[model samples]
Target: MPVNVYRNESLVQMETYEAEPARVDELVEQVRAKWSLLREHGYAGDYPIEVLRGNRNGGNIKVVEVFRWKSVQDRINAQTDPDYVALAGQISSLTTAEGTKETYTQAVRGFNHNFPSVGGVELLKGVCSCLLTIDGVVKDYQMSVKNGIVLMHRSPRMDLDGDGRNEMYLKILMHGGEIIQAALGPIRVEQNFNRPNDGIVKSNSAGGSDFPGTAIWRVSWKIHTPMGPVLTDPDQPLIFGPATVNHYPPVGTHFHSPTGPVALVHEETGARVGTLTPGELTAFDIVVTKDDEIYADVLNTPPADIFEVMEEWRNRMGDQEVQPVVAGATDGVM
Candidate 1:
């Protein structure tokens, strides 16, 4: 029957019924009497501690405190009485002093902040530059503000180097911890990405609505297919960007394809030459030649089909090689 109560919810009280300690029961009584004192004068935090139990034990009083916002530890420490020791010896005569322990477990909870808008631009720029341009992490990721505009770029950190950091993001918050916005982009990259990428550049057409450049610059895009160093077909697409030769994202150009997803390089020296797997052939097995000079794809390619239809773009360098890189097995159909 001895219990402290709080009506706001279930209850956060020091339960003694489950314990065995006569001295503690008495301490409970003395604690109740003391709490009654704090309650009468109204201490602080506008919250009052309610004493629901009062009994004799170990020559002391057993008690518990009830309140809102005030923590359980506060109540336990509040147990201060000069009379406890003398009273404890007296209570032990009636019942043997047993054992009890103070056990505690704390909890933590939280949520995410809204995406930043204005200052976020600069924040995102910094994040991308630090992660990508600075060369920290090895993985690459794209960064852009989403009021619905592609505004930033952050390449993977690890892909750029042998270093072991990931291109990550950080949220900017006020002194009070209220998050104001986000800073996102690549960081810690070992290599500089100078590949021709214009889809990510924002701009209008050369003759269309001019934004800021003397000529039309660029805009972001989602390339529908994969790209290669070259396509056998003269009709294949090239990098889609402002053409010193022409302007616009034409369908059959390298620029017209998606941004670099995979990397290609010389097999021996580990030098990157912008070679890539033709889209749809990611699973083909690879074998490095004994000379350590070139990577010989282990997977087999399709049999020569002089009679079978050949895609002009793929046959050259677009995707499918006219001769099989692997033997007679056609894998990763696209």
Candidate 2:
């Protein structure tokens, strides 16, 4: 009997196989060889888009194949093709378990900076902001063009504290100034644009009687549970330094979390700005300056809970006896 094949509207198909520990390598090679035949017979489009292999429990091996097909029908047809039948039969002999296939629709896909492209170029523009809160005071700063040049760099998502969850960071340079840096996370549901710049710090030089340029930074975050916004150290600035005349010192801030140290980076250029050296500092060393200096305000409430807020609004409207309009009613007549 012919093997069962799944069908869907998507152009992508994923096939997972389980094999014996000793035969895992052989199974992978056979699959790779079968891909060539499938492409030649037009049963499959191109080669597999992604291939992953790993060891599971009981010394078994798992191989996952992500194939990008020319169309959904092409994938369906390939499963029953004589060439595929023979190929699958050979691969099955090496496995101790049945294979599973799943199909998924592509939402969005893009290459990173290091990937080779036609123009040999990469996208280097991104946004970074900082949230400063101290003594129950809040302030924000965003990277912008200064002297016709942007002065910020954004780094790729990294687990600086080795917390498993990835975090993106931003770095910027400013004239002598002071501001509190708050722990923040992403506010938007689709974090493709705005990301969490957790554990980033800034530094400045010393100047004589000059109002040093304050680096206003802000980030957004939400709790996993339904706990409301909670500020832990409201009276502490992550880092603070004095102003310098005609000279901007390489004064940088660093934080030593329980897991490890985290550093800051440039928002636009993605270059390492300062090192996050392991050190000792008390909460009293931090300070909160002014709330009036904040540039923009970002709410920390999660968008996932918008339904609850809307329900409350609906209740208020019901209490007010707001009438619903009839369909096709004229203005002010319903």
Candidate 3:
């Protein structure tokens, strides 16, 4: 058995199965029945199975079944067991052809943060997003964050499609608060094609601006199914930073704690950027926010860094000195 571990935790093994559209339902039933038998035969740990319908292609429906086991040894033993063998044989008979299986281990960081608690059902509750392009039109669908949970899997870098380059899986929260997972590739088109002429052109001349232009690579999101790139929904908005008022300036952004908002400010000028809402912010924004607050406060003045402003507010609130009143005559005398 091949087992891979990261930082002392054994990676969870995932097995994916694809089958013809007509036989997917039947195959799922068969797998569940086999699972029941495996439990009776002393399969004690929690094992989750998901059935997803891939976009239809060439009259074939792609069905994906994912299985997450506690350990690679457990997976190997279960597959080689007599009962499992019989079940596999029965499942193969119903498929149009032999389904493919791939094994994957979960990253320790991703697993610990996402599925920290018991129960496999928690995996489906995390926020997810789906980006799809159909007929040359691209759109993004965001799933709402529920119970403060985000991402079924932390951005695990892996070669999910067996391509030479690695891809990152992003879980987007859908409009109905459901999960729609998508894969993002990091490699640029020019690099992937290996053609120097195909790459993006760079300019070295300074354009007299404080912020110089730099090349940034962006990846298009694709639906995580065997079916060849089908659009899921076109109406949903792309998942970005905190939701802000439509007319709000995009200069500054805010950070949030359990108590309330923490305004992000400029490092040198200490000018307020924008305010963040009550949810998770983007990775890029988080980095910027941390970088801005690394310096100490000069004085308790206007345009101070957010932390300094907060500290000043707390100090004023704690100081409670009574003001002296002028002496006055008794009753109506002034």
Candidate 2, lDDT over the whole model: 0.37
Clashes of each: 65, 23, 13
Runs off by more than 4 Å, candidate 1: 1-31, 37-47, 50-334
- The runs of at least 3 residues in candidate 2 whose Cα sits more than 4 Å from the true structure, single-residue gaps closed, are 1-9, 109-334
Query: Per-residue lDDT for 1-334 in model 2, tens only?
Result: 1111222327777889988888889999987877777778776654345678997766888998777677667777887888788988998898787788787753332213221111111112222222222112222222121111112333332333443332223332211112122333322211111332222211222322111222222222221111122221212222211111111111221111111113333344444332221122111110111122322212211232222332343344443422211112211111
Q: All candidates' lDDT scores? A: 0.24, 0.37, 0.32
* lDDT at residue 294 of model 2 (Cα atoms): 28
Runs of candidate 3 with Cα error greater than 4 angstroms are 1-13, 108-334
lDDT per residue, candidate 3, 1-334, as tens digits? Answer: 1112232323333334566667778877887776676566655245455666665565655656655555556666887789889987998887666777765533332111111111111122223222122121212222223332221121222332342332222222211222323432211110111111000101112232111111111111222223232221122111122112111011122111122222323233444432211222222111111111222222111121222323333344344321211212321111
| Decoy 3 TM-score against native | 0.30
RMSD of 1: 25.5
Model 2 clashing-pair count = 23
Candidate 1 lDDT over residue span 36-135, tens digit each: 5434433212344555545455444444445432444444434443344444334344333342323334322121121111111111111111001101
* C-alpha lDDT (0 to 100) for residue 72 of candidate 1: 44
* TM per prediction: 0.16, 0.31, 0.30
